[model samples]
Target: MLANRVSKRLLVGLQPVFKTPHVLPSSYLSAQNARKFSISSKCYQEQSPEPSDGESSASKKKDEGSRYYVPSSQKRKPLSRVTIGSSTDNARFRRASDTIEFSSWKAGILFVTLGTGLYFFFRYQKEKMDLQRNEESNRGYGKPLIGGPFNLIDQDGNPFSSDNLLNKFSLVYFGFTHCPDICPDELDKMSACLDILKSKYNIDIQPIFITCDPARDSPEILKEYLYEFHKDIIGLTGPYEDIKNICKAYRVYFSTPPDLKPGQDYLVDHSIYFYLMDKDGEFIDALGRNYTEETMAEHIKNHVDAFVSKEIREKRKQGWFSFLY
Candidate 1:
C-alpha cells in the first residue's frame, strides 16, 4: 500500500513512557502499529506540514475513490422535522384577522348612526318648541295671509259658500286642472302637508281650491282633479263673471296665454300662496313660499291646537265633559 503523507495526519499519543499495552506511537510509526493501539487525543499535538494555500478538508473530500479512502457501511441519522400547523389552522388564523377588520369597519357605521340620531333628536326638540311658541303667539290662523274668499263648492259638489267654511280654519288657493305643473305640485304639497297633519298632529282643517281657468275646469274636471290629490280638498268652478268677482274679492291674479292651441301646452299665471282664515270666515295671515312641508304642517298644527283648546274651554263651561257616560 502507498503511504498517505499528502493527507492531514491524525494525531497519536506516544506515552513516551508506556504504562498500558493498548497505547499508540507517533504517526511516523509503521502501519503495523496504526491499528495495534488506541491513544488519548488529550496527550498529543499532531505534527503537520505547512498547509498549501487553498488546500482544505472540503477539497480533500473531493479525493473520494482515490487510492486512499476506505468506505464504511454506517448510515447517517435521518433529519428531524417539527411541523407547526395544518392547512385549516392557517385558514382559521386568516379568518380571525378578517373578523377583527370587519368589527373595526362596522364601528364607523355605528358612530355615524349615533351622530345622526343625536342630530335628529336636537332638531325635533327645536321644532317642537317653535311650534308651541307659534300656537301661543299667533292667535288667528297661526300662518301668513295670501288671499280672501268668495262663494265656492264643497267636495260633495255643494256650494262651499263663505257661510259654510267660515266657522272653521281654512286654507285656500286658486289653480285650474289645465295647469301644466304648478297647480298639481302646489295641491300635492297641500295634500301631503295635510296628511302629515292628520297623522302627526290630528289637525282637521278645511282646504279649498277654486278654479281660475273655468273654461276647462268644469265641475266634473274639478271633481276628478280633486280626487287625484286628496279626498278632503273641495274644488269649485262657477260662472265666469261670478268666478271673476270671487277672484277680485280674493285678490288672485290669473290669465291664460292668448294664442293657445286646442289641448296645447298652456299655463296659467297666478300668484302661488297659502291663505289662512279664522273660524269666522275672516281672512287672517298667510304663508308664502320657501317653507318646507314640515314647517307648513307645524303652522297648521299650531292653529288647530289653539282652535281645539278654545273649543274645549267653551265646552267645559257648558259642562260637556259629563256626557262621557
Candidate 2:
C-alpha cells in the first residue's frame, strides 16, 4: 500500500514538471520529491527560450533553399510591356539584317560596274590598236612610197605611167597571168568589188594588174588572159629589171617556184594584197586576203563617202572666203 502511494506521487510530480495542459489524476507527492521536480522544471524553462521570426525564417531558408523565395518590393512587369520590349528588339534585328543585305547588294553592283568598265576599257584599247595599224597601212612606208613613175606597156601596147593614175582611184594587183589559183581568185574578187563599188557607191575604181613574170607575160599574153576577166582591168608588162624595180617600189615580194625545171612552165610565188591608191598615186590602204568582195566594197564606200564629204566642206569654206573677200 505505501509503495502504491509513492508511485502515484511520482506520476503527479512528473505531470507538473512536464507542464502538460491535461488534468492529472489525484495523487500526493513527498515534499522533497516535489521540490526536486520544481527545481528541474525551472532550470529547463530558463535554458530554452522561444525562437524569433528572423531566426525561424533563416532556418526555413537553410531547409528549403532560396529558389522559392521572392522579395516583396520586386514585382513582375505586365504582359503588354514585356511584349512591346520583345517586339522592339525584333524590329531592330530586322533592320540590321536588311541593312546588311542592302550593303551586300551595293557591293555586288559596284563589282559588276568595275568589271564592265574594265571590259570596255580593254575593248577600247584593242580598237585603238587596230585603228593605229590601219593608219600605218594607209601611210605605207611613209608618204606615197608605193606608187611612183613607171613607164610600162599596157595590154594595148600603149605606154602607161604614174600620170595615168591622176584624178582616178586605182586598185593595183601584182601577179603573173600564169598564177593558177591565187592570182585568178584575187582578180575575180577585185573585179566583183569594183562592180559593187561603182554600181552602189558611184565609185568607178580603175583596176590594174602588173605582171611579175615578164618573161612569159608579154603584152599580147596579158591582153588575151585579161579578156576572160574584168573588162575594165588594164594589164601591164615590162622588162624583167623594170618589173623588179616596180615590185620592190610597191613592196611586192615575188619569187620563182623552187621546183622549176629548165624548160617546164613554173608558177610564180608572190605576196598577195589589193593596193587601194588615191588620186596622185598616193597609197590609201592595203586589203588582205581575208577581205571579201562585199567587205572591200564597203570599205571603199566608207573612204569615198568621207572624201566626198570633206571635199564638200572645203568647197563651202572656199566659197565663204571668196564671198567675204
Candidate 3:
C-alpha cells in the first residue's frame, strides 16, 4: 500500500507538469499579444497625439493658418519700395528717350543747314556763269571793233575829239536837224530814256547829236534845233569829209537822192539807232526802234551794274581761266 501511494503521488506530480506546460504556453501567447497591442497603441499615440478640448481647437486653427500661409520669397513688396524702384526705372526710360530725341533734332538741323547752303551756293554760281556768258557775247577779240579816234566841231564851234567822250557814258545819234519827222521822234525817245535813267537809277549820260547833213546844219542852226529836244544835247557838225568819216566809223548808212542840189528840200535816209558807248568810249550796244524808252533805260542800267573797271578786267585776265578772259 506504501508503494502504491508513492506511485500515485509521482503520477499526480507528472500530470500537473504536463498541464502546466499547456497553460504556460497559452498565457505566454496572451502576454505577447497584449505587449504588442500596448506598443502599437503607444506608437499611435506618439505619432498622433489626442488633444484636449482647448488644445484641439488651437491645433485646428494652426493647421488652417499653415494651409493658407505664403512663403516670404513669394510675398508682395511694400508700396513705398515698389514705387521707388518703379520711379527709378521710369527715370532711366525718360533719359534714354530724351537722348534719342536730342540726337534726331541735331541731325535734322545739320541736314537743313547743309541743304540751304548748297542751294545758295549753286544759285550764286549760276548767276556768275550767266554774267560771264553775257560779257563774252558782247565783247570782241582784242580791242572793240566799233570805236576809234575822231575830230569834229560842236554846235558852239568849239573843237572836240574822241577824247571828250572819255570818263562818262555817251549816246551818239547820227541824224540831221532837217530830218522831217524821224530824227525829232528818235531824239524825243532818247531824251525820255535819259530822263528815266537819271531819275530812277541816279545815272547821268552824255547826249550827242552828229549831223549827217553838215552843209545844211550849221553850228547855230544845229544848236537851236537841239534845244527844242533836250537842253543837254550837244550838236556836232564838221566838214563833209569829217562827217563822212565819222559816219563810217559809227557804221551809219545814209543816202540822199542822187544829183541833189544844194539847199534843196529833199529827204535823207539814215540809220535810226542810238549807239551806246561805255566810259572808255568802247561800243557796248545799240538801241533800235524795237526798244521803248523804258526798255532802253533798263538795258543800259543792266550794263552799268555789270560794268567792271578796266584794271579789274585786266587782273581777271591773269587768273586760272586767262584763256577764257
Output the number of the lDDT-best candidate: 3
Per-residue lDDT of 212 in model 2: 93
TM-score each candidate: 0.48, 0.52, 0.62
lDDT of 1 by residue, 1-325 (tens): 0122111121112122222223423332333233222121111113234433232422332332133222254322221111233344334334445442433758688888999999999897666655544543444354424334456654456776777666678888888887778778888889999899889977777888888887677787788889999988888778778778778767788887898788777777887777776676656456677766789988777655544344653466479563421
- The clash numbers for all candidates, in the given order, read 5, 0, 0
Off by over 4 Å in 1: 1-149, 154-156, 258-265, 306-325
For candidate 1, the TM-score is 0.48
Clashes of 3: 0
lDDT for model 2, on a 0 to 1 scale?
0.70
Which candidate, 1 or 3, would have the higher lDDT against the true structure? 3
The lDDT of model 1 is 0.61
Candidate 3 off by > 4 Å: 1-137, 321-325
How large is the C-alpha RMSD of every model relative to the true structure? 27.4, 32.4, 37.5
Q: What TM-score number comes out for model 3? A: 0.62
Per-residue C-alpha lDDT of model 3 across residues 96-176, encoded as one tens digit per residue: 454425337786898899999999999976665566556545555686667678899999999889999988989999999
Worst 10 residues of 3 by lDDT: 76-85
